[model samples]
Structures are given as structure tokens and as C-alpha cells.
Target: MYGHGYTQPVKPPPPAGLLVLLRVLFLGIAVFSIGFMAWAPLLRLAIVTRKSLDWGLFVAAMAADVLSIVLLGSEPGEDVRTAGGYLGITLLLGTLAVGSVYYLAADIRHFHQLRYPAYPVGQPRAAAYGYPQAPTPVPAPYTAPNPRQTPPPMPRTPAPQPPANTPPPRPPQRPAPARIDQVRAELDELSDYLRKHDEGGR
Candidate 1:
């Protein structure tokens, strides 16, 4: 009994050094394009007259494509057929590899359109921290309370004189006063001295 194993055709690895060489060639082609316009007038002519060059390249590429198709269908056991298929696949892969540059260019163009424009140069940006400062509020003018209206005074409770039998209230202790004559004389002397000094200054 045979175990179930999926039978999908395994694609062969790209021909030896084929992919690498094609990449180098494409890079050279791009470099040539830049130089054509910048350094070499003759190279620029080839690029400027690209319509004819494109058609020529397209025809060659298409021929390579047809060859590839024939090779893919051919029997590998037949030497000629196997060789043709290998050559076709090689050419087809190279053509696609070259065309990828155009795809990349178109992608760049599409991305450019999607991009947002830059903010105006030299214009200052708002701060990312605090909000804009608010204007100061002016204080209201002061108004005096109405003089005519007055609050009624609170009722005072008079203390009843203690019953005569109750012990007489002890008087609060008071410290002896400074000499009245001395204090009065000191005040008079200070006032007179100040007055004389003020008059002399004037």
C-alpha cells in the first residue's frame, strides 16, 4: 500500500548565476540611464528616443517569452527540448526581472501622490505642551455698604446682683502703676525735644 503524499510539481531553482547576472545587468542599465541624461549626450539620445528602443526591447522580450513557453511544455528526456526549456525559463525570468524596475518606478510615483505636503517653511508651530495663555480679568469696582440701613444691636443680658448673703466678689489683683509724675514728665520731655528738633530741621 502506497502512503498518501501530495504530488505537486516542484519548481526548479533559477539557473546557476542567471538571476545574479540579470540583477547586475539591470543595475547597469539604470546607472546608464542616469548618466545618459547627466554625463553622456549619446546615452541621453537612446533614452529620449525610447519609444523605438522600447519596441525593440519588447519584441526581443516577447520572443524570449515564446521560447520559454515552448521549453516548459517540452519533454526533459529529449536533450534539445530540455535545453530549450532551460533557455526559455532563463530568458523569461530575466525579462520579468528587468520589468520589475518599471513596476518599482510606478510604485514610487503612486506613493508620491499619496504623500501629504510639508507644512509651510519658517512658520512657527504652536507649543505641544500647555494651552494658549488666557487674558487677565479686570477686578470689579468697590462699592461701600448702604449707610442708611443698620443692623439692630443684640439685646444685652444684665447680670443679677448676687444675693446679699452670697460672698462678696473678690476683686482682681492689679500690678502697682509706674510713677505718674515720672511718666508724665518723661512724655513732656520727649514731645518738647521732638518739637524743637522738627523746628530746627524746618
Candidate 2:
């Protein structure tokens, strides 16, 4: 009456190691994008020198690729063999990974070089985009204070009136006293019968 039947299905086999490696390499590239193009200043710095943040990212990608290869090769029930397929995947993903990093770094540098700040301190007012803006006009200097004139009073809302004199609803009535007494007597009779039956059986 209290059993729950639950079953766990078997997992499907993973793709070939080479295919898995390629996927991992793509994931690495995606992860590196966070620090590369996403942060333009770092990309620009990397562009100036071949060894910038991108180098660190590139190293991390290569390490991940090697680790993935080792893990996939050793995992049980995998079907990887021979050198051709292995070498092919490594070379393809490696080339793509490096090229993608360089391409993204270059794009970031281009954007940084082209982009200019809208507001620059110590610059000419007319050339600045959001600087100083036009000053609002002021009312002619306040004439001598007029004590007699007062500001208009604010208006207030009145509270709502309640419904005319109605009594609250009453609660439901309980069962009759005679009915309660009858139920108590039946319970006592059942208790006496059980006691006698239990003693006689013993």
C-alpha cells in the first residue's frame, strides 16, 4: 500500500573522442570570450604585445584539451583507437582555437581604437556632448517679500461612510445535548464488551 515504483534509464554512449575533443575546444573558446572581446582594454593590451590576456586564455584552452583527451581515452566502454583520428581532431581543434582567439583579440582592439568617450574633462564646452547643458531661466530677483499673499491651501479627501446599521451574521448551531449523551453511552458499552472479551480469551 505504501510502495513507489521508480526506474533509472541507462545513459547513451558519448560521441567519438575526436568529436568530443572538438566540442570541448569550442567550449573553451566560448569561455575565453568572457575575458577577451568582452573586456576591450585587456584585448587592446594583448594586441600591443603578442603575450597578453589572450595568451593566458590560449594556454588554459590547450591544457583543457589535453585533460579532456586523457579522460576520454581512459573512460570505460569508449571506442577510440589508432593515431589518425586522434591526430586529426587535435590539429583541427587546435588551429581553430588559436585562430578564434587571435581574431577576437584583433576585433576588440579595432573597436577600442575607434571608440571615443562622450565626456572629457577640461575640453571645450561646445565640443563636449553632455557638458554644462543650457542653464534654466530664473524668475526676476524676488521683489520685496509680500507678507499678505499666501500660497493656496491643498485639498483633502473625506472618509467613506459605512452601510446603515446592519447586525453581524450569527455562527451555526451545534448538535443537540441528547444526541451527544447517546453517543457517549454507545462508546461506554463498546468499551465494556471489549474488556470482557479480552479477559475471557486470556
Candidate 3:
């Protein structure tokens, strides 16, 4: 009636092959890390993956932008300045500007991925339950009374206009207010009947 108690949908379990593939990948990375200068992240996911992932993307973006600006402001090298009246310099600046834009876009995308990675790559949970992924909040409202039930009766004249002439038509008395207890009972009965009917129809 209100809401079926809400639950977060979970992804399905991955195949056995996926687990083996991951294990092999980690083993390779560990061997490579040992061959290299003992990078902790490569050796163990615990070092790479934090309680909160920080890719330093924003800092990288800012550094790219600032470095581009600095290069432009500095004195140009003799070789670059002489190439077709600074055409080479122009291309250099353009490349830096484009790279800066790329970094900025990447940082923004990373921010969104951090906040709302609803279906992340490989679709694995923190527990490493590898799985592939991907709401209908629909409740109907009552419009009219159920067609199967008889409608409640309308108000009628109190006593069939008894002794009309003697009472001089009684000044056309006001309609009586509906009785709460009676209306409530009728509603309860109607609800129960309609519920049962709906269940049967289903």
C-alpha cells in the first residue's frame, strides 16, 4: 500500500573463469612489481585501492594548465622561434592547450565516477564478486468505486413527507449531516471487498 520495503538490487555472480583470470592478472602484476623498484600498489591492491579512491586527477589537470601557461610566458628557444615566424611555437602551444583541456575533462569525469559509479567497470562489488550489470516505482490510485459493488444509497426524504398539509410543508428542512460511524463502517467494508476482488482478479 505504501511501498514494498526498498532494497538495493545486486549484480549476479561472475563465472569461474573470471576468478581465475583475475588471479593470474594479480600474480603477473606482483611479479612485475618485484622486478621493478618494488612499487607497493603493483604488488598489492591494498596499496593501490584506498578506502576512498584518489586518482589525483584534479591536481594533474591543474598542473597541466599551469605548465602550459608557464611555457608560453617564458622566452622561446631560438630554433622554435625561427621556424616559419613562430609556426612551430604555435603548434607547440596548441598541443599543450589541447592536453590541458583533456586533463580537465578527465578530472571532471573522474569526479562523477567517484560519486555515482552505479555500474562500474567489470561490475564488481568491494568484496570482488565479479559480475556484469545494470526501477519501476508504480502504484495505482483509486478513481471510482469498484464496478462490481452497488453504490451507496443517496439521501431520501426523512418520513415520506408524512402529514404534509398539517405541518404546512415544514419549511423544507435542511438535509441531515451524514453519520461518521456509519460512513466509516461502509468505507471499511468497501475496502475489504475491493481488496479481495482485486486479489482474485490478479
CA lDDT of each prediction against the hidden true structure? 0.54, 0.54, 0.46
TM-scores, each model vs. reference:
0.25, 0.23, 0.23
- What would the per-residue lDDT of candidate 1 be over residues 86-195, giving only the tens digit for each residue? 67656656655654455345333433434433445445554434467444455578888888989789999999887988899899975556676778889999999999
TM-score of 2: 0.23
> How big is the positional error of residue 4 in model 1, measured in Å on the Cα after superposition?
80
Candidate 2, pairs of clashing residues: none
lDDT of 1 at 25: 56
Report the C-alpha lDDT of model 2 over 44-139, residue by residue, as the tens digit. 334444665566655555555555456446545456464644663454455445646564555445344444335354443453433566544444
In candidate 3, stretches whose alpha carbon ends up further than 4 angstroms from where it belongs are 1-81, 84-88, 121-202
Better of 2 and 3 by lDDT: 2
Number of backbone collisions per candidate: 1, 0, 0
Report the error of model 1 at residue 2, Å. Answer: 92
Q: Model 2: runs farther than 4 Å from truth?
A: 1-51, 79-106, 114-202
**How well does model 2 score by local distance difference test?**
0.54
